[model samples]
Target: MTPPTRPDIIQWIKRAWASLTTATILGGFKKARILEAGQAEHELSHSEPDWKALICLLQQGNVPVQTIDSSKDIKQDDAVEEDDEVVNGVFD
Candidate 1:
């Protein structure tokens, strides 16, 4: 695979940072009882561009993270695509 360019890397960093920030805030809200557990989990899970590998990359790069206010909400569209490989046509 071809290596990503500088701009590409920067974009990924921005997206990853947003995801991490959202997760952090939501997690705190859940712990503090400010938000319900299911609501927190759903918001955290649905964040577009949320990638575990990106978080590791940021840590490896020694990026310092700042906490965001839990009262603020981060909303983004779903990033995942439909998968035809998940199932086949079933008998009627």
Candidate 2:
């Protein structure tokens, strides 16, 4: 099979980033509720600087940085075509 194209990689990154941001927002809300109940502050595993560093690394590698519009839904066709290979490569 041919290697994934640049558009495929960009779409994959965008989907992954969208998932990451959604999870982060939900987690923050959960933590806020816990704090309101008088629980101790929840420590974040990843800090803002860590995320920034990740973006910086991507930019340094010449990856185009595109702003995601959370208001719009990402179409199914825009998702990575080589999902299994990409996911396995990242995890394994």
Candidate 3:
């Protein structure tokens, strides 16, 4: 079989995105809550099957993925420090 074109992959991704409902997305959050509550074997319902298919297709196509390290973008100077000096005489 021939490889899928760029447009075809985009269409598949679009279909997968459409299949992702609010309930389906919120299911992940619900699972996190369940896990926090020390419950196991919680059946999280995933409504987006197309996303799995799209991922398989991308893996088969050998698509290159770029990863970002957000920590590298952060600097110590960016941290906000509270001022300890009190200006009570100026107000009085």
Candidate 4:
């Protein structure tokens, strides 16, 4: 395969960072969490950039993906004005 261009490499790294962080935040203290913690720690490391961390993620290929279902629902939510506070949380 053709070598990835510099831009592609950078894009991949950014995507990897976002994905790793997301997995960590949602996965908590599972194996993915451990991996995410380590990966992020290495990335916030220096001035130039950490290509090694991205390469490691790509090489290891065990990042757990959290499946999120796309959804949208319309609903009305209200309780009451308990102590005369303005009910301005949503526009009716």
Per-residue lDDT for 1-92 in model 2, tens only? 25566588878876665557534744564464422334343333543324554465456556698886645645555555554464545632
lDDT of 3 by residue, 1-92 (tens): 24455577779977866677745644553464422223233333454344464454355446665675556553545533454344774321
Model 4, position 48: C-alpha lDDT score: 38
Q: Which residue pairs show backbone clashes in model 4?
A: none
Which one wins on TM-score?
Answer: 3
Candidate 1: C-alpha lDDT: 0.54
Give per-model TM-scores: 0.25, 0.27, 0.31, 0.24
Backbone collision count in every prediction? Answer: 0, 0, 0, 0
Off by over 4 Å in 2: 22-92
Cα lDDT, model 3, residue 7: 74
Q: Compared with the true structure, what per-residue lDDT tens digits does model 1 show for residues 8-92?
A: 7779877766656666855665576655677525334454544664464456546675675534533232222344234455322
Best by lDDT: 1
Ranking by lDDT: 1, 2, 3, 4
Off by over 4 Å in 1: 22-92
Candidate 3, run of 10 with poorest lDDT: 34-43
Error of 1 at 65 (Å): 14
Sort by TM-score, top down from the best? 3, 2, 1, 4
lDDT per residue, candidate 4, 2-91, as tens digits?
344557776887776555553353355336443454444422443433566545654566656554432432222333334545657743
The Cα error of candidate 1 at residue 2, in Å, is 1.7
